[model samples]
Target: MFAEEFVVVDATSPLWNAARPFLDIALRIEQQDDSYLWHGWNKASIDAFLQKLPPHCSLMLGVWQVDAAQEQETLWLGCICEVVDGAVCSLRTFVALEDSRLPAIAQLEPGYIHAQELIRVTKGQVAPVAWALFTDKTTWDEWLLAADADGQPTDKGEALAALARQGRCVLLGSQVTHHPHHH
Candidate 1:
């Protein structure tokens, strides 16, 4: 471990209260072989969850199953995440999309503990946005830090503009003209 590394600490720990503002959490679960992701919790949800924690209870990060069709019980993991918000942030391990080990919800066997703790991190120590935006660090960095003077992305805007120019970004419901005379 480096002098500073990101790891999961108990949510009830005073360390968590001290660092809560800078944390972001992503939740995943397996239900009857189906994998679902809650993505990241919104601020209100997180705040509420934090307020309800008991002294040493586990932080629910994901789920594990112990049985099949007949068993509807879901297990929650003891985990929490602290990420640095930005493109160029902390280093983390990534599993490629094509990697065989990447769990498929349908194929997962339930009834196990899948508690995963993020490495403990301090403010500015890791980029939380990178974890949410991209799997690989190189790509995440290139996109996040590639801002121009206007603070827009360097590599992504042109394509989106081209799409918008072609009228792809508009929704059908929003395409109606409010002024009937204006056809």
Candidate 2:
């Protein structure tokens, strides 16, 4: 899990091509509801965001099917990482592309909430989500239901995370047929 890991993005970086697929969806979604993503997703914001960004943060281009996505709706996200209050985090800025930019797709399913939380995370933790330039604004991070000694979620978001971690399920007491305790 620890070798050498870092994402480099700028005007010259190939990550610019990553935006093409999600362009239409984010555009329509943003227009239908201004609350989803502002500015959409494009090169200008990426350039400006990069120009004003610090060395400690990063811009993560990832395929995400989070809670906001409806049934199997996956969107490519241009996540801008920045520093605030002495800690590195996501800026929460949304960039709306003009009419020609976008990204691709994938799915994580809707009924299962575990995949939503665990997919983007590594070792049960992910970078604080940010997209906007930050001077003082803040957003909260999320946690799972059960935890292990290694600090990873043992059981949560349904049984997905827990079953994958321990590989076996142990039921106890008399209530629902399925419970979280597994070993």
Candidate 3:
């Protein structure tokens, strides 16, 4: 069975107010998938339910089953919402490694690579579909470069300005019309 969780970084909430909506979705999804599969659920569902969920709620769908390790580390399926310019997109993924480096199967999986490339190409944006996994202090800087490369920003200066104006902005998951300062 698959386990699911909904995480929201509401503009009005203090806990995750600094977080981007898409990032919250990604984390919640990862956590739910991790917890659910540990309890022995083979199948999971989210798409149909998510379709009807409020824009403020971010969903994560995960599936896994017990394996020879007897620790339930084997994950069979995972997916998260990718947001670009306020649009929601889906990315199918699987975990190849966890802990330490926290690297995932997407690194070696050709299908995931192809899907990411397709998203980059089709979206006309430079941001990676899986950027949240690489988040840290430099995330904003990296995102500025990627957005500039993707043509989302006209130049470094403009990107910097936008970042300054928006702080840490996220495009996917829930809908946030006004920036934190705006309210």
The prediction achieving the highest TM-score against the true structure is 3
Task: Give all TM-scores, in the order shown.
Answer: 0.20, 0.21, 0.22
- Per-residue alpha-carbon lDDT of candidate 3 for residues 1-183, written as tens digits (9 for 90 to 100): 122332222233221223344344544554564333211211133333334444322222232222456633333333344433333443323221123333443332223343333333323322233221211234343542343223221343234345545543322222223446542
Which is better, 1 or 2, measured by TM-score? Answer: 2
Which ten residues in a row are the worst by lDDT in model 3?
Answer: 37-46
Order of the predicted models by TM-score, top scorer first = 3, 2, 1
Candidate order by lDDT, decreasing, is 3, 2, 1
Residue-by-residue lDDT tens digits, candidate 2, 1-183: 001222222433233354443334433542453233222333333334345534343233333334444533333343333343323333221232111222222332222232223222311233332321111011101121223455332233244334324532221111124445555
lDDT of 1 by residue, 1-183 (tens): 011444543455333432343344222121111222232223333333334433222221222333457754332221233322211112222211123433442442222221111211211232221111111222323432444565322334343233334533321111122333221
Whichever of 2 and 3 has more TM-score, that candidate is 3
**Stretches of model 3 off by over 4 angstroms after superposition:** 1-48, 56-58, 68-72, 82-88, 94-183
